[model samples]
Target: MSSIRSPFGQDVEKQGIKLPKKWNDTNSKIPTDRTMAVGGGVAVGGGGVAVSGDSSEFPRKRRQRYVEKDGKCNVHHGNVRETYRYLTDIFTTLVDLKWRFNLLVFTLVYTTTWIFFGLIWWLIAYIRGDLEHTDDGEWTPCVANLNGFVSAFLFSIETETTIGYGYRVITEKCPEGIVLLLVQAILGSIVNAFMVGCMFVKISQPKKRAETLMFSQNAVISMRDNKLCLMFRVGDLRSSHIVEASIRAKLIRSKQTKEGEFIPLNQTDINVGFDTGDDRLFLVSPLIICHEFNESSPFWDISQEQLAREQFEIVVILEGMVEATGMTCQARSSYLDSEVLWGERFTPVLSLEEGFYEVDYDTFHQTYPTPTPTCSAHELAELAKKGEEIPLPPLTPPPIQNPNQNLDGERGRGEWDEEGEVESVSNGDVKKMDVQH
Candidate 1:
């Protein structure tokens, strides 16, 4: 029998019949590998996609950072109509400012108040003709050393700071000068309260405590208790423990609604076992926080291959009260798609010692390869369902005969033979044993 071949390009070539000129020219440089161009990345045949790192092929675009790796908000507010809002909450604004700005404001507030009051004293001295009669011993100036703005300024500092050097004194002859001194004293107290309070609050900020609370540099995905889990390690460097600590995660990605509305930087919650109270951590040592892949998870349908192609970030937040100060503190870290490792698990950083367990921070962020399925959790569940449907062989039953039953089915009766030998029954045969002397 002769085999018939389809009229494909290869078959036509073998038959010495070439395709048209235009068709051959267009298909000459076709790639053998199955690859699809999606956006700026190439999807491989293994369901993985790779964004080209080469600048010529694809120039890298900077992703908008919602939260920086150091847990600072990268958002900047501008064009605000309520410009006076910051001043209305001036105390809070000053407290929130950086150390340099706070110190600058503190210095300026005291200096400006002092200079303004000094000008008033100098004006009073000039209006009373005290500057003109400097040599007259009879002329009692409002301020004893009423010569120029310098003397007035020196008196202002002494009055506000309560440092009475006894050289410069306010005279009782000028009742206006006495009232002015009273006013300066009250204003100086107010200024001290505002400036000193801002500095105190800024110095005692809990933000610095978060520095000792660390997160792993990279996140990893692997099987945990027969389920795929996304995990990251968190540990505290200081000896003091955090009280009532809990961890939370968010998936930040751009998404389009079913109504075709584009929402940029949409946040979705990733459960770290909050329902089962697993999110509350003891945190005596380094703990691996796991987010199990389930239906509610955004990564439920994401496979190891698709994860590399995803353009998303996972922001982790850890909140707790400082054991020493009893103040709440929050620490945050993020993992980009490039920072996530598939089919990998964190190396053990804790070990048993003589009296207590020891944590090795050197291996805190370390991870190693692990055996894991590349398929999505949804696909794995479907495969598991199909496996359950496949019928298994039935089990065989054993005979229900009692061990003490005799060959005649009599109970509690001994069997003996007349030849002085013991007889025992087998499947369907009897065996004789010789009597021992």
Candidate 2:
């Protein structure tokens, strides 16, 4: 058979064609091991689209590797919890500041500094002993309208804030006053830098990154189309879309190594929705993420009762680009085993009214009981089999014997049963023994 040739590229280097000297000399080794076919040509790795990680899948496929770290990047202490000794997280402290507290602190510093400098200027005027009075031309104090001490204090206020108001002016005629003005101006600049720096740090937090994103208050176990599933709701409160949004669910639990070292291990990824491709959701509205209890599921063997006692966490993270800022943003929340509700479903929160979609935020956290199996999927299947094998008890029909047959003949048949009467019906015959005498 002749060898087949491809037309797209130069599959056949025309007969006797030699390679260029540069192409031949270059170390042109191509990567061959990015993909390896193991066992009868089954490709395991070469650049396959990575399966999204959920808390319920194999850890080997879902593990995260540490890239790099620096001293400033790590925070050791917090206002709410002591993380380490002698180390404070300045970023966290700045982000946590309340608007009212920032305003109050700024006001106190402004007032105190103004009064302190005002007292200094007042004393300087008294020592300098100069005044600008009316045409009377007296040493009526350098301040034209106010008393000597009052004038100095007012001048200090004007100089620090506005550099100088004409009502309280400083001139070289009083050498002492002129020197004091220069010193106060320098002090005012320093104060301005300090106050403005604090305010700016507080105002410049990346709130947009975390805004409008939140996880459901509780995780739920319910049946979606007869398939048992673990579920939680994630939503964005803003109308601005999150571009290329991807979600991940991780089941974290403490694991001990053979070396006796214990660490939090992400057991697997809980691929949400229908299949592995279900990780990305169109989050135009509140979306319920679901993990089915199949063989690949972490909750396959876990029952409602077992879930309540287990110590584990379902960590959900949503990452996307903010449409408004074009900056990458991530929002995360966790559900401890205690927070997972079995046999409950989230109430409907989205509806269309008058051609407009409305979201009922009041019911965002509310869940109602659902018809769900309390046993694990495997256990329920076994119970269903057992039920099929056990045949139902037969139902016996009532006997055809007549009650009047046992009655005495002394009671005539014509008489009501209130007295004593008997009537008997035999096969194809009716016999009545009764007489009215």
Candidate 3:
């Protein structure tokens, strides 16, 4: 029988109890002399286990020890250390010093410095002309047109901002004005293009750009009389923007033959439109009845399985005028095996709720086989009557003949039939036939 010590440090045994032979030796190292004192010498037993002690003193001391040994403080310190290490690594690795060399800042500084110098030069020229006039008692001292310097300063500001105000005129005669204009114009264009390109790259890098813009993306095959119809729904999740979209679908096929393998197939652009008006923000573009798959059509030879295995991409290109600038967005959905509808057709069923559309296969299949005006009533009736009364043609018996007998009824055929096979005795005697034929 085995026994274990209880949580309260009391030895308990099961049936056929046998005390452990080494129990005393194992427990001998436990301190027994120390006894916790209670109120007025009320004390615990010699064993370290707590007994009836002074309630107030023991509870306070135990609470203090528990607080001192708590694990929460250590966990909090560890988390703080990890956060500090992460921030340090990020700052050290991702910091870019090259941004300080941006051309915009350089251009702005260059324009400001030159403009300040031009203003100073104009002021000095005006002051010199004024002093000369006072000394000579005349207003002329060869101050040539200081207006050119003023125009050059104004042009510098215009070029920096790419505003091209055109209020000030700079002439080739004034070489300083021409030089400043060329430098600022080129610098401004380059900086502006760089900034715009960087912004575009950042916007395109987001994970959402790769995600489909529409939810519930699917395509189905619908029957239209003797032909098959392909239909799908494309909708926008972000409802704020009015999207004008176009969709293009391609049917890809592969064939392997003795000569080689090739993908020979057709691609058709389906109809594109918003079910609602163009002014509406939220839209469900129902692309339906675009192409009819008939016996003569390229899609008739393509099985649904082949279409599903090949990468069938439907790319929707959306363009609109937003904030007075033309903008474009693209969304794509690919075909999966499970999404392909084999030998089935889809019909658009209207939902009572706005912005929702569903394909009704039951109604489509039931009404698809209905005869159209292509067949007249008289013609159909005549065909039906003829079909019912039609009888099978009589079969003719084969003529009895012997394989060994010739047309003259003579037995035993010659060793050669028709003409003897032509044998080419030399390579030069053999003629090459065109394999392509």
Q: Which segments of model 3 are wrong by more than 4 Å?
A: 1-186, 193-212, 238-244, 255-290, 302-325, 343-350, 353-437
Per-residue CA lDDT of model 1 for 390-422, tens digit only, reads: 222221112324433332232211234554443
Poorest lDDT segment (10 consecutive residues) of candidate 2: 65-74
Please state the error at residue 422 of candidate 3 in Å: 71
True-vs-predicted CA distance for residue 359, candidate 1, Å: 1.4
Candidate 2's residue-wise lDDT over 1-437, tens digit each?
12112111111111222223233433672233232112111223433424333423432211111110000111123234554532366444534668887688778878887788777776655565543333445554444444455665677788888855567565446676667667878988987887787787566543556657868766888777767889898888988888989888878665657997656443667877535667887789888888888878878899866764455667777888878767777777666555577766676778768989898777676664445667787776576668743222221212324433322222121112322332333223444434232
Residue 359, candidate 2: alpha-carbon lDDT: 88
lDDT, model 3, position 122? 51
lDDT of each: 0.73, 0.58, 0.37
Better of 1 and 2 by TM-score: 1
**lDDT for model 1:** 0.73
Candidate 3 displacement at residue 206 in angstroms: 13
Ranking by lDDT: 1, 2, 3
Highest-lDDT candidate: 1
RMSD vs true structure, all candidates: 20.9, 25.4, 33.8
Model 1 scores worst on lDDT over the 10 consecutive residues at: 5-14
Q: Candidate 2, overall lDDT?
A: 0.58
Pick the winner on TM-score between candidates 2 and 3.
2
